[model samples]
Target: MKLIDHTPQSLADYTTAQVANLVPDGRHQALREAIGRHQDEALARTIACIDKVAAWRPGEFNYLHSSQYCQYLYYLANTIWVREKDAASATRLFLLNKALNGIDLFYEIAMPAHFFIGHSVGIVLAKATYGDYLVLYQNSTVGRHIDKIPTVGEGVIIYPNSAVIGASVVGDGCVVSQGARIVDRQVPPRSMAFTAPGGELALRPAPEDLLREYFRL
Candidate 1:
């Protein structure tokens, strides 16, 4: 697929409205300003990476042009946004931790304009619809099922190895525990979902008292 940088044209260029709404209005405006200057930074970094890649024999690096150069800038610029955006800041730190430690985050997928990378690495947010304040940890996945969209409510916590998919409605103030799998279902507000035998599931007040503390906030 051709990667087009439409951020300059419209907010829709980044991702869906759901994802964009996750970022605070103030922060979103800041991101807009930062993106306006992204081209310059991207060009510089792209040229450097190109030169480094070029040293690895012929055809290792794609030919660079003004358009391609801007595209490079767009990617890096998004990375910068990811680094600084709310919630996503944690994710960026996790990314740095993985990079410095030589861990692989190949499974991580982030849609453009989806802010809050807080606690990112080891997290796999695939083709899923996310709401605001979506706090996630390592090994979490919002997977896809037959092209259906999973709806996650605001202020939700998806812990390690927790998988929710198939048009499921993950309610507000919910905490999905480690190693749990929820599919094609609706989890109520202020609840915890756990995996039971025979592909069954259980819902109860989240094990952690702090899980619902923010509901009052």
Candidate 2:
């Protein structure tokens, strides 16, 4: 994959500099080293992710791209946590992502490698069961209620301002439309969840394979 305006070493340096600038008091020498050690694996993971998104060119990564950078930061944090077991650096990366991207995706959250995001702003995800090809947009949320996390299946899209909460089951190929909320309810596969005229939940078959819009598959 081609990284625009960044070599491997330069991207690692840039990441360390960004994190250090955001948080000025950390012991960053080791953090820098850890990042260098794990950067290749993280970038590989990120390439696997963004390459599947239809909006981006398959073999190129633009560091200046907001959505791509957001995914890169996440992959780096996750790599540090899983490979180096360095929680401090991982937490810093997570906080830096939140500060820079306006999203709250913790380092511990397990996201699918091929999932796509329409926008990176105001998105929040809890420790939920997320499947492959998950699509999310701005202001979308998947949160837990009293430790009952949502189970979201593959090829699902959660639109802006929509939420799946409290043990909700969003089945395969479901679309939680804009402004819809599924709280403790089950949305069957290949269906669309939207707000009815009476402001209640409504389910109907999805008009098409919406994932085609975001993913190459």
Candidate 3:
């Protein structure tokens, strides 16, 4: 993939610099080395992830793009956490991503391979069961209730101000509408979820075309 204004090594250096400035935990060397060691793999994984987003340019990564940068930072942090088992280094990257992107994604959460972050602001993601072709918009949440996490299926779009929590099972090709909540319910595949009168979950059939708005799948 083509990187805009940065090679892999330069991006690693730049990311480490950001962590040093923002986190300032005096572990710059460790984080720098960790990022340097894992940057190439992390960026290759990021390219695989971003290539699925229909809204983005194919085969090009622009660090100046806020949402793309957010995704890359998450992959870098996740790679360090999973491969190096270095929580300190990973945590710094997570914090730096939150600071710069206004998103609250932690390092421990295991996201799917190909998901899209439409906007990065105020999106708090829990360690829920995410699937490929997932779309998370600004102010959207995927959280747990009383330790019961959500299961979001493939080809799903969680629009702005929407949430699926508390053991909710969202099926494939579902669209959680704006300002809707699906709490402990099972939404059928290829359905759209919204709030019925008096705060009940309502469903209607949805087209796969809706999900294609955000993903190429």
Whole-model lDDT for model 2 versus the true structure? Answer: 0.91
- After aligning candidate 3 to the native by TM-score, how far in Å is the CA of 131 from where it should be? 0.9
Q: Count the backbone clashes (under 3 Å) in each candidate.
A: 14, 0, 0
Alpha carbon lDDT of residue 95, candidate 1? 41
lDDT by residue for model 1 over 1-217, one digit each (tens)? 1223333335222422222355443344444445444534433444443332322222222322322332243344345555445334333323433443222332133432222223444555555666655556666778778887788886677877788988888997688877888888999987898876765679898655453332222
Candidate 2 has a TM-score of: 0.98
Alpha-carbon runs more than 4 Å astray in model 3: none
Q: Candidate 3 lDDT, tens digit per residue, 1-217?
A: 8999998888878888888888776889898889888988888888998787888888899999999899999999999999979999988889899999989998888888898888889899999988888888899988899889999998888999998888999999899999998889999999999889898878999865887677776
Candidate 2 residue-wise lDDT, 1-217, digit = tens: 9999999888888988988898888777777898988998898999998888998998899999988999889989998998878999998899989998889998888889888777989999998999999998999999999978899999999999999999899999999999999999999999999999999999999978678989998
Better of 2 and 3 by TM-score: 2
Pairwise TM-score winner, candidates 1 and 2:
2
* Alpha-carbon shift of residue 110 in model 1 (angstroms): 7.8
Q: Pick the candidate with the highest lDDT.
A: 2
Instruction: Identify the superior model by lDDT, candidate 2 or candidate 3.
Output: 2
Lowest summed lDDT window (length 10), candidate 2: 22-31
